[model samples]
Target: MQNSKWVDVAIVGAGLAGITCGQTLRQSGYTVAILEKSRGLGGRVATRRLMATCADHGAKFVEPQGEQTQQLIQQLCDRQLLQPWTAPIWTVDAAGTLTPTEPTPRYVAPEGMTAIAKVLAEGLDIRRQQRVVEIKSIDAQTWEFTTDSGEALPLQARSLVLAIPAPQAVPLLEPLVAKGLPTAVLETVRKAMFDPCITAIATYPAEQAAAWHRVGALQPLQHPVLRWVSRESQKRSMPGHEVCVLHSTPAFATQYIDAPTLETAGRAMLQAGAAWFPGMEKPQQLQLHRWRYGFARSPDPMLEPLPHAKTPIPLVITGDWCRGSNLESAVEAGVRAASLLEQWLNSGHD
Candidate 1:
């Protein structure tokens, strides 16, 4: 075995949480290395290209609820990366009746939601496409991490933070838990749940798909099949490129997660979306995306320290599911996790 490389902090999962953690630690004058499984960053803040059209497949827009988000939004606005979405949003009932709701200002990344992740990841030592398969306490002051690469070289860190979802993180922390770590932390992690969502992106020829309403997006919450129907093109003022992003309810998505085709997997969602919004027809191009851990279920373990009886390396478990009350909860959890880690690292324990 090769001598493991070491850093001050090692974080897995380069999503919003991981990136935010890396940013926090780096700004605090600590050396942190971020490892991500995917080729690109931004776990849920995703964007895709439907031929020539740009669609936000994961999070459509961010509605800032907390004070932290307000400040972040202002910074994003100053950088010209985010703008307020002033479009009309309506809720369609089961009877196919459109109920226009009051307009609320939401922040949207004009470049794409991934732009936000990119901004947070700037100047951080992020290792993409490297999934840390195993984490073990080598000594009291060191923790070793093994990646999924063919060689599986070991990397060690003085401190570790997990910013991924609970389901994904549970397996990683299982080694520590099985070694007689806190049972409460393990139970809390097991109880963490997230809703599934299947998004269908339908793109049409230029000017072929016309808007039924002047609004930017629509939500068919009462519909049995479709949960949301958004005109992604309208949000960014993409002229001539008509596109719609359809989202299925958690139950429906779970039911059809294994369906064969877009027609079958998203049949109900597509049919209901087209029925509610005019010109939402089967498009010239289409894409299907499945988010098994989409929206997080509320009330999870957050801001708690998982103290090891023997190991000196402290572990902080955090994710969007911590307090899934709102979209900003994940971001909030990320910020808090960093603060906790910094405090722990500066303490006598480490």
Candidate 2:
């Protein structure tokens, strides 16, 4: 049955951007719903359990560079959702020469990385596994969203916030140009570009990983295949086995982005990493993940307040790509997007 729901605002992509936008709107007494395509939250702030231990496959740690990010970290720490990872970061050359890096503050979640998203998602109406396939303007004041599966009912809202990746958001927004959607908005979204990334999770015997107590995390310098390798156990205490997460260079990911299978790419990354970290070539278990839009090559300019005067309706585009490809960028974009939609509605445009 294609039932329908009406809300003050509807958000696509329950990543930090969508969740942040929804939370911001809900605080103003607006009925909002966040639809997520995946079962998990936090987008790239993800973690996975393997064998007795877990590995942070996505962003290894959070380093607050700005005041806003620092404030966010302090809040999370106060709530016990975040803790400082005082481990040292080192740089490794192609020939496996390790050099010490300057000390910096990095934070992590003891429970898991996704815990950060869970806390931010509190008291919000978040619907997971809701893949939005189509978007339509239902008159000037309302927008409708159709899910990929028939099990979900269509959602209608007075305003819409697209918090997904630029590449994914383009398809849904393209057809709306004929329906009064601004070509400039679509063109701005198109200006954003991303580089692909391939991540591999590997686990080895606990004894082997314990041997490298001096090693924290390694950033490969000018490596053709491997870019980063994280020793998961170094930051957090885990038992039974040692976990390592490897990230491939953008060039490597581009070459294997459309391959029939990623097994070859995964193995190549692990093999390349073995040069710096022994036993990486052999693992008890291995898992592979591909991020088609991993890092932004070019990000859209940060529009503090969207130009609502020229917009046809209360719709805003937002994502990490709207600013930069970091967690802070996503949060900031969400806040700006929410501010735009709120202004549009309050100005009697809704």
Candidate 3:
């Protein structure tokens, strides 16, 4: 077996949480490595290029709430990495009456939402397509991990962070509990719940695009199938055609989560969307993306990353699921997780 160089910290799931955590730790002079399962970087901050245009199929936009998130947003804006989505957002009630939403600024990237991840990921050591399969505590101050890469050797680190969803993280930590490690943290991770979502991206001809020219996006209230519809082209400039992103209700996603074919589900969502905006049923191009852990259910805003137990090394479990189901929450959690890990290291726990 080949031996790889040990790092100060190794983080799983190169999503927002993992990237943010790694970035913060690196600023503190720690050598960090971010391991991602997917070829893409951002977890939910995704964008798809189909037909002649692109659409943000995962997170529509980011609305900063907390102080840290606001500061991050301002920094991104100053660098021209992000811009305010000043387009009008309207909400549709059950009676089909549309009303303008509050004039709060929603931020988006000019190229795509994934640009945010790319910006934060700059200058970071991120290993993509490396799905961590096993983690074991090697000693009082070291941990080792093996990925699905079919390599004989495993990576070692003084500290580790599981920044993926709870369901995905549980299996990796379960084996450690047998060695008297992370039982308390495991229970807390188990308590976290997530809902699935089915997102549909459709592009319409210019004739149909003019119908909704005044509206930037629509939130359908009390809808059984469709939950949100946004003109993705408005966020950028896509000529000759319009791109729209459709999000299915959580209930609809739950029912179709295990469908034999997702095409049917995608069509069904488009059909429902047509009821609100005609011509959505028939798009020039269509794409579907399913998120298994789309949103966290009733996450406690006051909660921080799960505190480590009396293990030999420092281990942290964190994600958007640790707090709320939003980009801002994920950023806040990552910052906090980095701080906690630093504390543990400073106290000579690892």
Identify the candidate with maximal TM-score: 3
Provide TM-scores for the models. 0.92, 0.94, 0.95
> How far in Å is the alpha carbon of 17 misplaced in model 3?
1.1
Of 1 and 3, the candidate ahead on TM-score is: 3
Decreasing TM-score order of the candidates = 3, 2, 1
In the range 1-350, model 2's lDDT, one tens digit per residue, is 14677888888998888888898889988899998999999898888876665778887888896765787798899998889887767898867689988888899887778887887788998889889988877656677777887434556787888889888988988888888888888887787788999999988888887556777888999989988888888767778778888999999999999988899999999898777677788888889999998887634355445322224457887887777778888888888888887877687773
Residue 60 C-alpha lDDT in model 1? 85
Give the Å shift of residue 324 in candidate 1. Answer: 1.8
Q: Give the Cα lDDT of each candidate.
A: 0.76, 0.82, 0.84
Error of 3 at 342 (Å): 0.5
Task: Predict model 3's lDDT versus the native.
Answer: 0.84
**Cα RMSD, each candidate:** 2.3, 2.0, 1.6
Superior candidate under lDDT, 1 versus 3? 3
Q: List the residue pairs that clash in candidate 2.
A: none
Please list all clashing residue pairs in model 1, or write none if there are none. Answer: none
Highest lDDT scorer: 3
